[model samples]
Target chain A: MQIVVDLTRCQGYAQCVFLSPDVFQLHGQEGLLYAPSVPEDQVQRVRQAVAACPVQAILAGEEVAAGGG
Target chain B: MAGELRDGRIVVVGASLAGLRAAETLREEGFTGSLTVVGDEPYPPYDRPPLSKQVLIGGVPADTTGLPTRRDPDADWRLGVAATGLDLLERRVLLADGESLPYDRVLIATGTRARPWPDAGEAALDGVFTLRTRDDASGLAERLDAGPGRVLVIGAGFTGSEIASACRERGLDVTVAERGPAPLVGALGGTLSQLAAVMHRGHGVDLRCGVTVTALLGDGNERFVGADLSDGTRVEADVCVVALGAVRNVEWLADSGLAAGARGIACDAGCRAFNMYGIVTDDVFVAGDVSRFPHPLFGYQMLSLEHWGNAVAQAEVAAHNMINPGPLQRPHLAVPTFWSTQFGLNIKSVGVPTYSDHVVIAQGSLEARRLAVVYGYRGRVTAAVTVDMAKSLDYYRHLIETAAPFPPPPGAADRAIAADVPIPSDVPDPKGLSHEPVVALTGHLPDRRLMVVQPTR
Candidate 1:
């Protein structure tokens, strides 16, 4: 599964980072860096991160490909 | 069990973050029965954290801050109507519109509202405002844009501090009056609030601490012009924001037979609410700022959290427990986490900071303003707060969850953990502060003295 974070809407709350640290990391206070492609073992964690995001800035699965397009 | 749970009329009260998320989770968990969401406000669910930050900063319009739904929950939306009462016996929700909706299971997420000034007439003054709803933010945003002579913020809590930050950024003179010893003392404790006080002063805010607003001195025409403080000083301002914090919307549940009051509705770890007689109800659940659920991490204390993450996590847990059978149901054990951005600082905290008795600067220096303060209670890590050092918070959260020893061991921080002595956290009693604390440590007195009684066996 692939994921994309809406950088424009990301307020750097870091809920995703806390849930799925392998996929998302906060560079500084507000700069967020994340892996777009989720590892097979990390898919469930990524899904939880997606729902746990306070701003709902995360998108996964086919929605990521569609959003990128 | 799956077949038995597939269909049921589930009714969700409150259409804000918790309510919306619960509805979505119910559908996602495959509960295909009738779903109805009832809200007191006319607008649908919207994100509120931005209302005090970006909206006040004029970066986004308040009305445009609606939350994006994961998918259509296909639920009946009941907007602009308050849930007047809950008939637990008949399993019906009584609305203020004189209509009753039946439900097989009900989720109460009525959240909270801003506590207005005690004086109703003074609160009705033209320039007085409270930031809670979208309408409140929009109106305050417009007033700030008009360039008021001075803005008098009556509370130095998160909302009040953010408002002062916005005013200073917008080049408007502002004065903050806090009843505590320093800004954020009631929430983050006295140690870090000193830094907050410095930041406020450093930003040219007329910071006045240890004083309360005696009276809002409105002009003869009922327009706010200034305020008198307890220190025998008056501040002249064109606008005033009463950031005195929130009051739970549990008034409607007065006769509902639930154990709800000023501290919010009491619930078990599974989000199942209890009655006044302390009996847990299987069909009824509670979530969001309106919930007071016991957390094992905090000594099974009932923690009432007003954080965004908790609202989402608890709502999902409540929805899952509503649909699944007993054995398959899970507890809402997610540690309470919240973040605040103000005065160019990103403050993030995990676990209940107020639950701790001591705090140590485990990483970085206080002067640098980038450090992680780990809180401990009875030799175990209870919570941690990071000011601009948010990356290390998750590690502390692990320590808290595992009940790691206080003054955390080495390698938790990027550098070797400093052998700093833990100091008293100096968390003031909530009763002494004017603003409502973000996390209320209600009904859990770990330090209370208990007598040992011996009886003949």
Candidate 2:
């Protein structure tokens, strides 16, 4: 699965860093750093990270259709 | 468990972030029931934090801030329709258009609205603005782009400070007038507010603390010309932004008999809405910025949080409880977290910082404008606020969740010494605050319940 963070939309809230440390890490007063793709073991956490983002800046795997249950 | 979970009409009010997330989570939890989302606003759910940040600084257009759903909830969205009243006995939601939505279960996530200036005449001025919805951001952004002579922000809370930061970032002269002793004193306490004051001054912002803006002056064109401060000074500014705070959208429930008031909709830890007499309702729930639920970590004192993290976390738990039977229901007890960016500093917080008596610098140095201040009530750590330090928040959140000792331990920090001396947190009374305390304590008095904590050993 691929992980993507929109650089422009990111506000450096770092909720993702707390939720999924293995996949995402935030530096001192800086934007987060993370792996572009996730292994099978890390996919669950990467997905959680996406939902945890305050701005919805993170996208994991294929982007879900806007407005799907 | 009473009965098997089955398909039923699930109605969610307020199509904002919390409402949208709860709807999405309902489906994720395998609820094949009919779902309907109702919102007074014409547009679908959109991000709000940006309305004060990048949108104000012109980084992105306000219209493009719609929150992308991970999966569509396939809800029958009732947009631009306000829910007038809710009938608990009939299990129906009365709409403004004379329609009623019948629901087996309902989630009230009616969030909050930007608290407006009390005076209608002053608020009607052309240059006055309050950031809450997409249209508000668009209108305010247009003024910011015009490079007004001076921008005046009335409030030094997070929202107010962010607006001032955006103005400074855009190279527009800005003045911040706050009623508190210092910027962010209502939220992060005295010490961090000092750092925030320094940061704002460093950015060439004219910040006035411990003073209130008594009146807004107009230039006769019905445009904001200046503001009269209580300290006997007048600020000449063309644009005035009111970042006072948010008021919970609970007026619709006035006759609903739910325990909702200015504080917020009162709910149990399980997210079930309580009646006026404090009886918990089964089918009705509340989440997001509008719900006030007592947190166990803070002596079960009820809290109403406006943080983005709290909204998402509370929504998931509320959604889960909606599906499960009573015994199987999980409580919404996630540790509160919030972050803000302003004046080139990244401020992050975990736990309820305002729920404390003393604060100790746990890491880094306040003089350097980089540190984590641990908040304690008595002797146990209650909350922590970190400036320009995001990584340390996880550690502090753990300490808060576990109810660790005050001053915290030294091992978590990279610095040689964690400032362990306890100083008064200096969190002001909610009544004296110009803005609503984002994390509000509604039940019980703080002085009586929030007695000081000393070391357990």
Candidate 3:
């Protein structure tokens, strides 16, 4: 599974960090630094993180099928 | 019905505190269907109350002010986009990005934006600021931390007074200029406002009343340096904060055909949005600062409240009605309540004090800076304002709800002066003392139209 976050929409509420610390982290004072992709085993955590975000800035989905390549 | 039934989608515009809370309540009420929330700001929903207080004082970081949610409603959030229009017949919300989201029901919680200085270029100056969003608070906090020599705050509304209070608390020199006869004249009437002026001056605020800022002067580098008052007084300051009240976020609804304008999105008692022709739509609802709903207690006068408590309560009511049937639904009739902490004073108000014609001291004394002023109209208790005596406000709120008599039942301890001692004074207009009250009695209607209509000959 892959998680995508629009940086501009992130307010550093840290709810994502609270839900999935390994996937999302706060960087500096205002920036929200987070991993864009996660392993299948951690997909649930990523989903929880997306759900917990107050601004709803995080999104998780299946990786694009590897057929085009 | 016990399981997740696939009901039609519910779309909430504004993604504000009220909108988000309503969405959560819909799920809690077992409305299992698609949900979409749209917000103009890029960021997700966050708390706004702190932006004016703790955020400005740097006690709480701006970005970290997001409100804690009990549970997450997994729904599509359309951020960085705005709802441009509403098609009631088609049941679709037109987005600025050209995408239209269909909904079985829609909620409008497009709150309000901070009123900016009249001069666009002058307001754009580096040192000129208005506190509303997280970005605004963060930027202003940063400026305050830089130790500006002097801070000039225009208008003594709650936001303006709080900003001045924050500056003074930081040991910085500050000045507050109010066009009204006194600070908070719009909300608390003139007598209490006079007390506010005294408090501000006692705290070294250099309070200036009955004057207007004609022009904002800028330094050679284009940063706000001073302000020219209408009375020919040029006050030098490194920074200026404009707190001219708020402008309801209803412009996008202009073309939506809904009766949305500067006041707000007009709605019926059931929270259903009304059209230009005064027709109400069931599928569409409005809550929070964006909603102008009629209150039965205030003689069915349509009130547009910007209070925090009203937003939460109205959102919950809007949410329940969105999912439940009509019989089980209820009106959002919670008495309007708001509190402000400034200059070491905790000011709380219940009901619409400005909507009343008379005010009397129900408890404590104004001289001691601890009192509750009960407002009345035609002998019925209309509203109450408390300064450092908030506990008594709850009782007065009940009095207002029950339409208790003016000069209400005597204080509990019998400490108050004769009931007639605290006579009602004229509620001054925000524009100036010469004008009438800003919150006028529109007479048993949701819109100002009915109040203005003259009877046929």
Candidate 4:
């Protein structure tokens, strides 16, 4: 599964990091770093992180990939 | 569970973040039941965190802050209508319009409303405001856009401080009157709040701490002109924002058999509502700021959190539990997390800081205004707050979740001098504060030294 975090919308609430630490990490107070590609084992955790985001900044699935590899 | 109950009616009361998210989650979990979401507000669910910051700063219009729907929950939205009462025996929700809607399961997420000024006449003044709803934000934002000569803010809680910051960012004069010793004292405690005071003063805000607004004075036209303080002084301002805090919307459930009270509705870890007799009810669920649930992490204390992350987490748990059986249910055990951007600082917190007796600067330095304060109770880590140093918070959160010892081991990432003697957290009793704390330790106070005394001879 593919996932992307809308950096523009994210206020660095860090819900994603708390739920899927392997897939997302907060670099500083505001800089959010996340893996765009989700591994098979981490899909459920990524999905949960997507739903848990307070700002709804996480986007999952290939439908939202926007032609990115 | 009976096969006939598969397509039951599920009603969600409150159409804000929690209500909307729960409804969507119910659908995602394959709940083929009829979903009805009721909200007192006219508009759909809208994001509120930006209301105080971006909206007030003209970065975004208040009306445009509506939350984006992930997938249509296919629920019947009853907006602009209030839920008057709940009939546990009949399994129905009574609406304000004299209509009763039967439901097999109900999720109570009525949330809270901003506490208004003591006097109705004063609160009704044209320039006096209390922010909680979208309309309130829009009105206040409009007032701020009009360039009020000077703004007087009562209560220096997160909202009040953010409002003062927004006003200063707009180059408007702001005078903050806080009944507490300093801004954010109720939430972050004394040491960090001192830094907050520094930030507020440095930002050109006329911060007046340890003072309470006795009365809001108005002109003959009923427009707010100034306010009288308990310290025998008056602050003349064109606008006054009464950021006193929030009151739970549980009055409507006063007669409801649910365990609803001043703190909020009492619910079990699985988001199942309990009756007045303390028996958990399967049909009625609770979530959002309106629900107080016990957490093992906090020593089973019934924590009442008004944080955005908690509302979402609890709502999802409640929604999932509503559709599944007891053995398949999951507890809402996520640690409370919240963040605030104010006074040119990004402050984030995890766990309940109030549930601690001591705090230590785990990383960075207070002098740099970039540090993480780890809170502990009885030598066990409980919470941590970071200012411009959020990357190190997850480490402290791990320490808290693992029940690590206080003055945490110094080997973690970006580990500072953990041996720095832990100081008293200086968290005062909530009774002494004017602003409502975001996280309330509704249960036992942690680390109360109870001496075991033997029978006197």
lDDT for model 4 comes to 0.84
B138-201 per-residue lDDT for model 2 (tens digits)? 9999999998999999988999999998899899999998887888889998889889999899
Error of 1 at B224 (Å): 0.4
Docking class of 2: incorrect
Q: Order the candidate numbers by TM-score, best to worst.
A: 2, 1, 4, 3
* lDDT of each residue in B166-202, candidate 3, tens digit only: 7887888998888888878788876788888988888
Residue-pair clashes per prediction, in order, are 0, 7, 3, 0
What lDDT tens digits, residue by residue, belong to model 1 across residues B1-457? 7667769799999999899889889989899999899999888777687688767877567875666567667878888889999999999999999999999999999999999999999899999999999999999999999999999998898889988987887889999999989889888887889989998999999999889898898789999999999989999999999999999999888888888889899999999999887899999999999999998898888899998889999999999999998899889999988877778887888888888889988887678878888888989999888888766777888999999999888755354234368889899998778799989978846598563332213
Q: Estimate TM-scores for all models.
A: 0.87, 0.87, 0.82, 0.87
Give the TM-score (0 to 1) of chain B in model 4.
0.96
Best by lDDT, which number? 1
Write candidate 3's Cα lDDT for A1-69 as tens digits. Answer: 545553323445678888787766543233344454465677788888878877786655543111211
- If both were scored by TM-score, which would come out higher, candidate 2 or candidate 3? 2
Q: Write the per-residue lDDT of candidate 4 for residues B1-457, one digit (tens) a residue.
A: 7343347999999999899789889988889978888888888777677788767876567765566556768888888889999999999999998998899999999999998899999999999999988899999999998999999999899999999988998999999998888999889887899999999999999999888888999899999999999999989999999998899999888778678887899999999998887899989999999999999999898999998888888999999899888788999999888878787787889888988899988887778888889899998999999888766667777898999998788845555664377888899877777788888877744597553423223
Q: How close is candidate 2 to the true structure, as a TM-score?
A: 0.87
Clashes by residue pair, model 2: A68-B71, A68-B72, B377-B453, B378-B452, B378-B453, B379-B453, B379-B454
Clashing pairs in 1: none
